[model samples]
Target: MAQAADAEGTVVVTTTAEGGRAGARALATAVRDQLPADRPGVVAVGAESGGGAVIVIAVNTAARTAGQDASTLVKHLLHGRGGGSPELAQGGGLPTGQLADTLAAVPGMFTAG
Candidate 1:
């Protein structure tokens, strides 16, 4: 798993999984569920699929307070198509190699957005 704190002090947690969409979403949900309720956080889980990868994200209430939208983040940063509520989102058709790098860059992207 990878963890970083965004400019707003929202913890961003990310990880990779072997399974596809279902697996990534499951892992993301697991990680998001583990975060303390009082803390602001985001969880991202990526998994390889076909020749690319899919990313799943979950945002907590505290994180949403800053107007964090997982769907928008993935679509903008990864150039992939996806949609979900501000609290949960998933996107796919991204370069598999870029998964980690993109996840790592998430915190910094928050500032730019």
Candidate 2:
């Protein structure tokens, strides 16, 4: 797993895990669970399979309060299709090479809370 934080204290984490969509979701949830209670964050978990990747984005409450939407982020950053509430979202069919870059850009997608 890799992590980055912005000036606003929003953390972004990226990880390549095993399982497919289920694994990605579990990883994202785990990352979110590990964050400090006061810190806002986003977790992007990707699993590579066949020729592409599956991604799951998990947003903590503080991050969601700061206007971060996992569903929108997955759609915009991964160029994939999926849906979920603002706090958690899952998507797939992303270019494997794009996963890192997409996760790296996550911190910048938030608005100040």
- Candidate 2: regions farther than 4 A off: 110-113
Give each model's whole-structure lDDT: 0.80, 0.78
Best by TM-score: 1
Local error of candidate 2 at 76, Å? 1.4
For residues 1-113, write the lDDT of model 1, one tens digit per residue.
66656556778887888789889888888888888777788888889988898888898887788777888877776675887878889888789888888777777865654
lDDT by residue (34-93, candidate 2, tens digit) is 877677788888888667887788988888887878899888776658778798898777
Candidate 2 collision pairs = none
Report how far residue 31 has shifted in candidate 2, in Å: 0.8
RMSD values, in order shown: 2.0, 2.7
